[model samples]
Target: MGGTDDNSNVRSVKMVFVTVGTTCFDALVEAVDTQEVKEELLKKGYTHLLIQMGRGSYFPKKSAGGSGCLAVNYFTFSSSIADNLKSASLVISHAGSGSIFETLRLGKPLIVVVNEDLMDNHQSELAEELAERKHLFCAYPQTLRSTIVIMNVDALLPYPPADAKPVAKLINRFLGFPDD
Candidate 1:
């Protein structure tokens, strides 16, 4: 409940960017909007929480303003999220291949939250594999709070750029094709 405009003491703002891509993942949107989550993020030294809600029916009731030290804001969509991704210290994204690779290519620490409601949940397969390699952490909506509590950003390995052979090999491996 403490709100202030003075950020002079803050050297550089660390933002936690959450994107759900082009689909609705309300569970994700709602999960990060909670007071408990915000407090946890603040404890981790993050100053902002920005959510790209995409086509979700649920919008967080929280206002787009600074709540204590953490400024929470969200939007429905954007033409290009590259700038947002670039600015983030950490990214919590839906388990979409595009989102996954882009954030990884930026060499940012990422946590991919799998939406378990989808019928053909390929997201889990990709997220789990990436997590297994320690490139990023994977979580479900139910486990996300706990994941945030325990996440050590320094422990994540940088994901190789897409043009790199390792990425090609990873994709091939994910698709069940023999490494060539």
Candidate 2:
């Protein structure tokens, strides 16, 4: 993703939240903190990037040779992330099912980055399923920045709106209610 292009897109993206859950996801954080990625995001007009840097050892402020553009960005670990979820224009996250479900509940466009190093590639399964359903996009940390740039958030759309009729009917049937 080359830096310097559209102004409207920049104006459109006001806040982007990148979360690695409560685990160490240095790779994903590092990808976003890369000079190239920083420049690309700046060019795209995404000024506010709040990173939930979990247990990662790398600190953006202490990183060497990083552009000052990232200096003003927000970085912290917060367990109660509902506020961030509510405010973010887009969410880029680890492919944890909890995060996926909650983000979808908020109706935000999510990009899932699956960590293959973890035990059992189950998150990959969930990520792939959601990606196929057009509910989210998936990428490895290695390709995260490019994936973000290449995929237009507007086109990706929010998760399909929730429908409760089927669930309600099933619950009522289980309780011995007459079939409608």
Candidate 3:
């Protein structure tokens, strides 16, 4: 990690979370487990890698090979979702709507790693649309290293307000502050 050490009292080492959702995404996890990916992430100052693998056949090499910095969870439910998102500075997840909305709602930098194997190629379109809108970035296992190298939290733009003018006006009117 290229950040200030804990003893230095400067910046804290960050956490990167990867989730494969309910189904297996062995390929994505495996790619992220490669030595090249590991070294790049470490150099980027991410001290911890938290992976939620679900039923995936492969576990992260870093954790399996006895590196204390990487943690892998084989399964998780919605109860675990919020804490996981809140703890991570960046989230790399299967391109599912639940994870996408949740990550965006939390304003976390997200990388939507599309699993073309599982979704009958449906995730590709969704990933493309989201990426086009600048809501997130997407990558396949083969390009994982380069994508992570270019990962930028600053590239995320502000989300538009959820309520339209009429909706806001309705709420205010209901509160007896109408037509102001």
Candidate 4:
């Protein structure tokens, strides 16, 4: 189940997608420093995108690209790229619950950088637990360079866990909506 897929679009490049979740982390100013990480990833042949999903953040009109990396910042979720999680061969992200769940569900190899000073450090704690369990890769901003080197998107794939179904019935369980 763990092997490179040449036919898979993921093997073709390295990509980073960020999800800030529903809350804002002022400490995310640290991400401006991602320029350094971007340089290193490009040297290793990867493209980077930074999506900002916070109240006061703004998506850049221009793309963030340099040193062979391409990055984009968005203030809100773009439906066009929602499936980017599923299609990306590798994902670099913030340690948000929603982000982690979606990445794991898609079976993509992930390098999660936590949002500092938010939620009693819960995100960091969660990232650590998951990393120890072999569920995902985790790192802090300073160590990002070394972490990226160890990643092989091919090593993460074909998730073995059966997709979970709901444990309880819906409140309006009987009606199936028509396709519009």
Candidate 5:
């Protein structure tokens, strides 16, 4: 594990995981499914692209399991995406706090795509703040390609790990269970 490898068997797969959470973000799904995005990701040394499409009506038709150079796969939902996030070398996610912070806590490079069609769109504020701090890159569906082209994962600042104790205690009280 410590040695450098020039062989395929010794190399770990570099996967790029995309998630839209439980909301429908078809624009985002469509944006990354394009040939250009896939090629760009390959050029950036990523070996696979996995998308969690959420409840979006649009499903990616291009490359599923059998693709050239870059393998692309997508799904509507999953019981747990913690494993996916942990396995990913890079993450492209919706501007949802859960998705954003989860990836951030994993110390993975992240690109947050904002759903501008949403009514309030307060998620953009959070994305913008994180982007300002150099923790992640922010993009809209239209700018995803350009953002991908220019994104430098090495430049991102690592997000500090979050404390779950307070939240856990609050939930425990609400459920009438003693705090652990």
Candidate 6:
């Protein structure tokens, strides 16, 4: 299971943690600004705490928070989001296999941010699949502006499946190891 750290250096900002895999291609597409979402988040008094997946992406030096609106791109992960996922109060992330799985396992509320530029719209397909499973919130970039307003960060927690052993085995296989 994934874990979180309630205490972090990012406490000053309203933490909206994000993870987009290593390429940042998904990060670029998913990071598109829907002015409405930005405005709504600002109105709600939130400062965006972005944890981008790319180590090379451009991050702003300062942020405006809920006042003027600034996107502070914080840390990037070379491996998994398991560590940073704990620090987030809300997560806006790419709809990738690893990210979605970790989000569900962590029981954290997730906003399915799809990457349009990659894999023949596979991300959208995956988002739809996960949404069908009642795992988390899903929205297109266009709708994300409005959707963020109605999102209840607390309402997205998923109950772990009873048949968790198979899931655990699958994860072990994915991690390239035999189940213990």
Candidate 6: residue 43 lDDT (0-100): 62
lDDT of 5 by residue, 31-119 (tens): 99888888788878888889999999998864543334677888988999999999999999998776887788889999999999998
Comparing candidate 2 with candidate 4, which one achieves the higher lDDT?
2
Model 2, span 14-111: residue lDDT tens: 56788988988888888877778766666666666778888888775432222335333546677598999999877889876668878887888898
- Pairs with steric clashes in candidate 6: 4-86
What is the lDDT of every predicted structure here? 0.87, 0.73, 0.72, 0.60, 0.86, 0.64
Tens-digit lDDT string for candidate 4 (113-165):
87665656766876887787677788875677777777665655443455311
Candidate 5 at residue 146, lDDT? 89
Candidate 6: tens digits of C-alpha lDDT, residues 28-134: 43443445555676665567756565644555344555337646655565555666787776777777666777767777778887766665665677677667666
Compute the lDDT for candidate 4. 0.60
Better of 1 and 4 by TM-score: 1
Report residue 172 deviation for candidate 1 (angstroms): 11
Candidate 3 wrong stretches, greater than 4 Å = 1-6, 9-11, 62-79, 161-180
Q: Could you tell which candidate, 1 or 3, scores higher by lDDT?
A: 1
Candidate 1 residue pairs in clash (backbone atoms < 3 Å): none
Cα-based RMSD of candidate 4: 9.2
**TM-score to true structure, per model:** 0.84, 0.74, 0.75, 0.64, 0.82, 0.66
Give lDDT: candidate 4, residue 36: 66
Clashes by residue pair, model 3: none
Relative to the true structure, candidate 1 reaches a TM of 0.84
Decoy 2 TM-score against native: 0.74
Model 2, position 138, has a per-residue lDDT of 92
For candidate 5, the 10 contiguous residues with the lowest summed lDDT are 163-172
What stretches of model 2 exceed 4 Å from their correct place?
1-13, 62-76, 161-180
Error of 3 at 158 (Å): 2.9
Q: Tens digits of per-residue lDDT for model 1 on 54-164?
A: 999988765444546578788999999999999999999999877888899889999999999998787799899989989999999988989999999899988767554
